[model samples]
Target: MDFSQLKKEIIEYSKTIGIDKIGFTTASTFDELRNRLIRQQELQYQSGFEEKDIEKRVNPALLMDSPRSIIAIALAYPSKMNERVTSKKGERRGIFSRASWGEDYHLILRDRLKKLEAYIIERVPEAKCKSMVDTGELVDRAVAERAGIGWSGKNCSIITPEFGSYVYLGEMITTIPFEPDQPIEDQCGTCNKCLEACPTGALVQGGQINAQKCIAFLTQTKGFIEEQYREKIGNRVYGCDSCQTACPENKGKNFHFHEEMEPDPEIVKPLLKPMLQISNREFKEKFGPLAGSWRGKKPIQRNAIIALAHFKDETAVDELIEVMNKDSRAVIRGTAAWALGKIGGETAKAVLENARETESDEEVLVEIERGLAFFK
Candidate 1:
């Protein structure tokens, strides 16, 4: 069996299935990634969402029996919305980062991966394969980088020359010993743009990040965001794209190759006040298709309250007050109270003073005081 010919065949078939870019690499254990991850663990930089077992994340042999190669694929997503949402002064909206704009990328990548898997199975019935997207144990960036899909960028994203960093990455570990593709040279040289652009200074240095401080990670948290980051989060409700947007390589690199990845501007950039009032069912029905909705609405709503505060949107003060006074969740009520303070008005001040008297949760009371302190 000529494995090289088979690898060439796989690449051709991948293009037919809407895979924008595909590359192959030997599946030997990722030594460099293991060292980097260990250092990340030492610095406590991990987001807590990653696979806890570091070995499982770096060693392909652990994920599958006798893994010989990894096939890495990148699907480009649009960096710009094709249509524009009307901007009105009194109406405020929060932005979901470009990555979350379209249909959930996990499903898109998984569907492509399933197709690739089936193709391989037909060609080589004995071929064993295991695939994973972002949630998988193996680091997608590491696989893509080694597979020559892209160079690992300073923003911690795999940046393809054709697609820039705006690409969704997934990989398959297989028994076939496909010839490896050469990795692209790291071209980020002397450009400190991504690190400099990070609002939270989450990019501690080039190619290293403290995920705990990243706005993208913060927006996904269920608890109260620290007061310092609340202001830095700006109008981003789902994720942060500042670092990627700042990259010189990414300039003018927007691609809408996959229709499923095109965003509906109204849904991805919906009005902020309505988000504060969204019922769980309504939130699901409206945002269920987008990747940003995976963490559910609480985090998005919390960030929306922060965005209102960031905008000082006087129109939203009343809705914020309702959330502050009536929302069942302490985090929601507390975030609303803080936003009310930030969006300060006589009504907001009066409500905060009254809520201070009635709010039971200690954390909510602390936020209420934080809100009231803004008046002084």
Candidate 2:
């Protein structure tokens, strides 16, 4: 079987299917990434969303039988929204990171992978392939790096020369022996922009992050956000983009290649107050299609409350008061209490004082007290 000719065919076919970029690499164990995962585990810096078994994450052989190579594909997303949301004088809005702007990337990437796999199978009847997006055991960034799709940036994102860091990556492990592409040279030389721009200093150093402190990670957490990082979160409801936005390489690097990648400005940057009261059905109808909605409406609502406080949006005071007093979830109730304090006014202070008396949950009470402290 002419594997070299087959590989060339796959490359040309990939372009016709809207895959922005494709690269190949031998399926050798990722020794460097394995060591880094161990270090991140030791430091408790992992987001806990990653696969716990570090071995499975670094070795492609474990994921698929006799894997000979990995095929990495990138889909570029738009960095700038075509339509911008206009915030009224008293209205406040929260921004979802660029990643969560459009249809969930996992589904989009998985569809592309399936198409690639079928194309490969048509050529080589016996070829076996395993495909994965972000949730899979295999680290997508590491695979992309080895496949020469991009260099690992200081922000811990894969930065392709053509698309910068604003690209969604996925990979397929195949039994076909494809020649590996050379890894790109790291171009973030002495550029501390990403590290310096990190809101919580989550970028501990170049190409490393303390996920625990990352606003992007924190926004996904189901629990209460740590006080130190709450103010830093600002109006980000889903993920943070400070690191990527700060990188010089990503400057003016906006691509609107795929129609599905286009964002609805109103949905991505919705009014902060409406988010607090959105019903389960309404939440699903509106945000469920976006990747940011995977965590459900609670975390986004909690962050929305925090964002209202960030802007000190006096108009949201009434709604925040209702959430503090009546919300079923302690995290929401507590975060709303905290936000009420941060956006203090006579009414906000009064609601906190009332919630302090009626709030039964111990954590909620603590937040109520914390909120009241702002008035003093």
- For every model shown, the clashing-pair count is 0, 0
Per-residue error (Å), model 1, residue 199: 0.3
Local accuracy of candidate 1 as per-residue lDDT tens digits, 1-376: 9998998899999999999999999989889889999999999999999999999999999999999999999999999988988646679889999999889999999999999999999999999999999999999999999999989888888888898999999999999999999999998989989998999999998889999999999999999999999999999999999999999999999898899998998999999888999988999999999999999999999999999999999998888888988889999999999999998989999999999999899999999999999999
* Model 2 lDDT, full chain set: 0.93
How far in Å is the alpha carbon of 292 misplaced in model 2? 0.4
Clashing pairs in 2: none
TM-score of 2: 0.99
lDDT of 2 by residue, 84-194 (tens): 988765788899999998899999999999999999999888999999999999999999998999999989999999999999999999999998999999988999999
Cα distance off (Å), candidate 2, residue 344 = 1.0
lDDT of 2 at 158: 98
